[model samples]
Target: MIRIGAVSYLNTKPLICGLRERLSGIGKLSLNLPSRLAQDLAAGRLDVALIPSVEYFRATGYSIVSNAVIGCRGPVWSVRLLSRVPIQQIKRLALDEGSRTSAAMVRVLLSEMHGLSPETIPLAIDQTPETVDADAILVIGDRAMHPEHGVYEEIWDLGDRWCRWTELPFVFAMWVARPGVDTTGLAEILQASRDEGLRSLETIASREAATHGLTNEDLHRYFVENLHFHLGPGERAGLQAFQEKATALGLVDTPKSTL
Candidate 1:
């Protein structure tokens, strides 16, 4: 049976709705941090994983196995950068250890937009933002949903920043498989799972809102307004642009091909 790994973040709910039931006999699904999922996929512990987009570029023999992705056209409320200093003046930054793609995105934005390359330290998953003593801190997933109490120069929703700056969508993660894995019919299964999640957004929001310290309406709006699941032409273009930028920054290698 196929062993699949997915992110444990609320943002990933839409991509995995009813996925376990659908894969009951075909595969087993495990929830983990995006970083962990990537590591697991690389170590051969997982046959398939919803990995960070940057990991896809860095991996030597991985292939995108599904069209469904976690992306944003405009504002994505879950990935944030909180700064005590101005954007151009940030000299020290703390990156969320649970992230891979977002960490790369933040670096790319800092380099391209502000022309600043700051010293970055990892904010361990068990540590809170308040505990990090950097000029700025990047946080992703559920913790980012609730903004830090003290703020200063900027609070950037990375998705909003990328979309506004590039005029294109930002894809965070997608289903990928290691080399030699037989992915027969996997794309269709993933697509159907995404469809089921989209259709059940309201129910999902209702069930998950309070757990994430958000109102049901707020969560629902986030799913419908902030996020996009399909990897259409626009998304593919954006993904390509991102890869190009990341490659130029030496964050990842040039991807061999598309999904």
Candidate 2:
């Protein structure tokens, strides 16, 4: 059976909705953090995964497997950088432990936009942003959807910043398979799952809102307005742009080829 892993973030609901049942006879579905899923896929523990975009750049033999994606055209409320000081004045940053892509994105944004190379620390997944003492902190996934208690000098929705700066949509994650894997009909299954998920957003929001401490309306709006689920020409361009920037910044090695 194919061992497929998916990200466990709320944002991924639309992509994986009804996926388990659909894959019942053909594969096994599992949920994991983006970083862990990347590790598992690279180590041959998983045949396929929906992993962070940066991880895709770092892999040598992975192929993008589906058009369904986790992306943003403008402000993505879930990937945010909260600063305690001015952007240029940031000297130290703390990154969420669960993020591999956002960490690289934050570094690229800082270097490109402000020309500052700040020291970075890790903010454990269980730790709140307030627990970290740094000039700025990067937060991702469900935690980022909620506002922190205190004030900051600047709050950047990384997707919005990236789009405004590059004029392309930002793709956060996508389905990928290890080299030599048989993907003949996998793409269509994933795409169909995405379509079904889109139609069930209200049910998904209602079921998940309480778990994430968000109102159903707010969660539903977030899914509809702040996120994009398709990988098209614009998203592809943005992905390539991000890959180049991350490569130049030395966050990831040169990619073997485009997916």
Candidate 3:
């Protein structure tokens, strides 16, 4: 059985909508935190995963399924940097362990975009704000959507920041398979699931609201307006830019074609 790993977040629901119902006879599918998905894929515990983009760079021999991605052009509210002071004055920053892509982006932004070398600290998934001595805390996923309800002095949307800096779309995640895994059939099934989710967004929103504490409207907006699931030319250029910056910063080894 093909062991496929998927992210357990509200943003991922649309991509995997009706997956459980349709994929019952296909293979063994597991829902995991995004960080764990990368580790599992590297360890051979998973054959394929919807993994963070930076993790794809860290590991080798992965072929990305065509035309599928978890991405956005601007104002991705879920991946944000909450700051106690102005961004220019940030001396230290806390990064989320669940996201390698965002962490690398932060580094690239600080160095290439902003011209600052802020000290970066890696924090656990459940770490509290008090644990950070940094001026800003970077959080990703559902937790970042609300951020202790008004505790932050300013919230910087990473996607928006990237667009402002590079004037291009950003891809946060993708469906990747280990080398020689043969994801042709699996990719078609996943595409069908994504299409189903897109068609019945109301149902997906209701389910997200019930489980993730987001309102249906918020969930719907996030899925429909805020996030882009398909990888297009602009997104590919953005990915290439990110890879270039990451390589220069020594965050990634090299850039493989995502075409």
Candidate 3 lDDT tens digits, 162-213: 9888999999989989887867678788888888878988888887685778
User: Which residue pairs collide, candidate 1?
Assistant: none
lDDT of 2: 0.92
Local distance difference test, each candidate: 0.92, 0.92, 0.84
Sort the predicted structures by lDDT, highest score first. Answer: 2, 1, 3
lDDT of candidate 2 at residue 37, scale 0 to 100: 94
Backbone clashes per model, in order? Answer: 0, 0, 0
1 or 3, which is superior by lDDT? 1
Residue-wise lDDT of candidate 1 within 7-93, one digit each (tens)? 999989999998999998899999999999999999999999999989988888898899999999999999999998888889999
TM-score of candidate 3 against the unseen true structure: 0.94
Off by over 4 Å in 1: 257-259
User: What's the CA error at residue 202 for candidate 2, in Å?
Assistant: 1.1
Ranking by TM-score: 2, 1, 3
How far does residue 125 in candidate 3 sit from its true spot (Å)?
0.9
